[model samples]
Target chain A: MPEELPPLGDKVYLDSAAAVADIPDGAVILLGGFGGVGVPENLLAAMADHPARELTIVTNHAGFGERGLAVLFRQGKVRKLICTYAFHKSAFVFREIYMAGKIELEQIPQGTMAERIRAAGAGIPAFYTPTGVGTQAAEGKESRGFGGREALLEHALPGDIAIIKAHKADRLGNLVYRGTAANFNPVMAAAAPLTIAEVEAVVEPGEIAPEAVHTPSIYVNRVVLGENLELRSEA
Target chain B: MNSDPKLEAAALTPGDIARRIAREIPPGAAVNLGIGVPTRVANHVEPGRGVMFMAENGILGAGPRPAPGEEDWDLINASREPVTAVPGASLFGHADSFAMIRGGHVDIAVLGALQVSARGDLANWTVPGAGKGGIGGAMDLATGARQVFATMTHLMKDGGLKLLEECSYPLTASGVVGKLFTDIAFIEFTEEGPLLREVAAGLTAEDIQRVSEPRLLVAGTIGTLTREPEAAEPGA
Candidate 1:
């Protein structure tokens, strides 16, 4: 009764642009990174050049030091951003556009933002937290007392696409990250409908040790190998 | 950056303020340091004190910035500045890091403040006329930490007291701050109000009171905060 699934081996994309070609207008996307580490540079490069418009970007911060996401923001592709840290020391472009009211921002607490994405990946619909009790963040959210403290009910946030980076990816899509670059990438890889990874190396199935795989292959849908990845533009 | 030039000369140096806060960190306490001046507290922490540093960016036991030419770009603090992991450091995903914060696993949170009310309310995330600055992890730290310490200068550049009877700026959390450390003095919050605990060298109770917006109480055991023995004297 059901159609057979596509062959599972050799999931590599020819290039970053080809990997993200199917993302249409008005889709909600999750970008995996904190500051600049672990960001999918080649994937963001592709998104910057793609014709998609009015997209909602959920990221930890507007890309820092590097011109990765800021390039996309400059090109006027992002319609709304759901982020915890929208302002960075080097975020002049994002600040100018935000101040001009050209783009929308839904600021969230860094921890809550991370948990919301993690919850979606874990199949949890909502969770309660005491982080925003009695603050402006709890203004419209539902709340009830838990134990002795009041907790705000927060919903899980799912995305249409998750663009993440890893140090290496096996042909099976298992991933591994380096040091602090592992911050949000693993959780995001499982929280979206279409999980696309831009990794530095794509190895054979047995090359990536099973113990080192931070993201198991089941959650990954696409893999793009990034060659000579440069977070900043040459120009 | 201060609008008030009159009090600019009297402020304590950022390093001295960090030393003052570091002295309060008890051994074995897991502390979260907010961005800006609070990050400098890592530099002033006495070595082998066993005070663990937590960053919202999923790093626990974060050490000082890496040595020149030894920097690892992937190992950074919440400020995105390169740092080394201490001996017991553990790296985790963002969700677990916030779980430590929101779940009250963190013992202390030292944060920079724009304004602190006499009622112990805080407003440090954004300026009044400035567009919404990112909240980051302040709200979570303010609400979740067992104790909150606000490290800031006593007065704004405009000479306005940051320690106020009521904060005019947007609030980060209400009744969350337990202690206040400024260039001029150390004030502890009580049900009755802010009680002055220690004053910097040469400044009298009257001098501190003049700049304080809320009524400042001279605690029965008020002590003088001394400069580091290794440093030069004021105006030296």
Candidate 2:
């Protein structure tokens, strides 16, 4: 039988020192977050530590300073950062590298990025949004009307592997996430080719009641358990 | 102020008025700058005090101006204008970004204006000649800002002054305007609304009135014009 997503544990360690994606170089990783608030921190750290290079990161801001996706930029692991909002809090090192043309960057509007992530998770090929119709985001992208007003049609994203975070998970792969971390994890978990999550606690199967599970056991692949959650860590 | 002046020592040129507008904005305020002349304001924001900027397309703590040959193609402004994301900036989803604007989080909004009548109705972004200017977050900012400031030429594109009895275009936010920094003079919306706040260094009230299409309320006390930003000169 063809494998969908792996049903692993709800609770797993999202430690960069422990386990994470073994993504081959030149792979596309769809990063999910709206600013650093919803970022998968531990997963990001693991990716940073890994030896992989030439990554095309699909993210909004890619984080700023010494934290989040900016670390990847500092390491030169990213070949491209495909997203918007480069003006507000870009990492200093990332800016220097990008200015040097050491990497390729694809800019998308803030609104379009959000809708595209939603589209990928929902299994839709493409959807139109009224956000970027008349501006530069509409450049080369197709435009159509939904309710008389024009909206831009953005393509859905399918990644080679999906990394995410959770607050608590059962051994059966059921997950529950806290506030801001809860933003993109469920959808990201559902849309990737391989979905791995790191959680603070891992309990026995059925230990987490069906009512409390944020993500069902059907979508998860491998579960790495870590005891203490890093400051806002995820896949 | 009534029109009809030949020449005077206090009259300011259009360029000088640009200078004055630059001095009005504070050094560090979380700003959502509107397009057109307001975009020019970013170049003048003093470097390094950490002014957090918001672009509805999803950036916080946005940087100002890119160094020559340093433009990050993957990172841009709400206009998709090539820009550099500042240190400590973060990118996120559109919804969360808009939440900041709609939630009254931005400190101030500086935008361009097409018309500012004696009664301060702002007409910018779209003027009907242009198709669907896409309000984007302009409406959110106009009403959301702790203060709404505008920068524009004193006249219409057809050589007519943009100052009018009231705005000809659709209103974005009624009575939301706090100040008007123009190329001719510095005006503000007061309890009386759209009162003449200040005159340029080399300009007089009568000179301002002559160029303005509409009548202006003269300031009771003569005020001085602000100086344009130094960064604007470098880019220009």
Candidate 3:
């Protein structure tokens, strides 16, 4: 007789707080967003109240106004930031903390940062590109010649956890994003060991067409219903 | 401001520079407009030209800024300003968006520059004394685009020449700029040197040479640069 298999449990959680409850201190978090879009605002709010400290966050921008990542920075929960753009006019919180030398920052080119995270998800160790050759961005990095041009070696960037926002998700954790809001969520979803997604709505598994899914359920570990935050374009 | 008649007449407005650059773009070319003055190029491109605007933050075929109360937070440009998507537009993740840029699929990149060398070296990201500024996609766009153009003022506020023999600011990319459009002149970088192509209506070649640090080579008759009148606002 064949061995009996255990039943599979649904990935849905009641709220954002419960989804992010297990995040420990000193965790490397890959945050999915580009400016104002694709940010997991509800999950970030929950993290602000959580006791986790000393987090190293990887994202596109540091923070916009006084919400989202800015709130976490104001609370002293973030220890380091790996991002492309760090100092916008409204990102006063990150700028103040960084100027005081209270936090660490590693600035990467926008394209290179995206590729590094994508490489981690694709299981590639490292790759070479000609984006930052002969500039300060190439300092302390290995170089080689290819096709009569020089390229720099960039390594894959992995994270301990990935927190992302999606437009919709199935109970099986399949995700779909709306418009430009898909910016960094798909890449971050694949680069982390534990991926928690905050979605506006949850549906049955068959509700989402397989071909229309932006992120497959295999990469997502959990999904929770998030409050619909007001959408503004200033950030 | 104490300004000479010749100096005042030679100056072209920011709109002139943007419209001049827009006329140079061929039909059906994919263009990436950098922040600042270059962003205005999109407003001048005639409709139905099939020109596509690529925003580095994962948008292709980006349209004009939306009217008030019609802005969608999910739809924005690289500058994080709310914009509309043109017909047949497509959206993707950051990885694929940058792949389109770094892979050299973009035909033209129009960027604003702080300083540009005669040899086409570009330096615009950060100044020497200024604190760390974001690189964004400038380096990738500079190195990957088939042709790079820079739009900037001809002189600094202190009356210093911005077209230099060598850039004082940090280099965004070396020998990437092919064409330059300034408030006073339009020039092209050739293998020999920079060739003066056009000048403002009241300025002569000698007048341009006075402000430019590097020697400008003039061949044939120089054309006068002029801006077309503004088009009527849509839905007005």
User: Which residue pairs show collisions in model 1?
Assistant: B2-B157, B3-B157, B3-B158, B4-B157, B4-B158, B4-B159
Q: Put down candidate 1 lDDT per residue, B1-236, tens digits, no spaces.
A: 44433445445777778878888999888999987668877777766788899998878888887677888877888777788998989887788888898778999999999999998999988776655577888998898898999988887766777888888887888899999999888999999889999988777777788888888888998878666643632211
Candidate 2 per-residue C-alpha lDDT over B180-200 given as tens digits, one digit per residue, 9 for 90 to 100: 887557888777656787876
Ten contiguous residues minimizing lDDT sum, candidate 2 chain A: A226-235
In order of TM-score, best first, we have 3, 1, 2
- TM-score winner between 1 and 2, please give it: 1
TM-score of predicted model 3? 0.94
Two-chain DockQ for each candidate model: 0.53, 0.05, 0.69
Error of 3 at A16 (Å): 1.2
Top model by TM-score, which number?
3
Error of 3 at A113 (Å): 0.3
Q: Pick the candidate with the highest lDDT.
A: 3
lDDT of 3 by residue, B99-142 (tens): 99989889999999999998999997877753356777888899
Q: Which stretches of candidate 1 lie over 4 Å from their true place?
A: A1-7, A232-235, B1-10, B130-132, B228-236
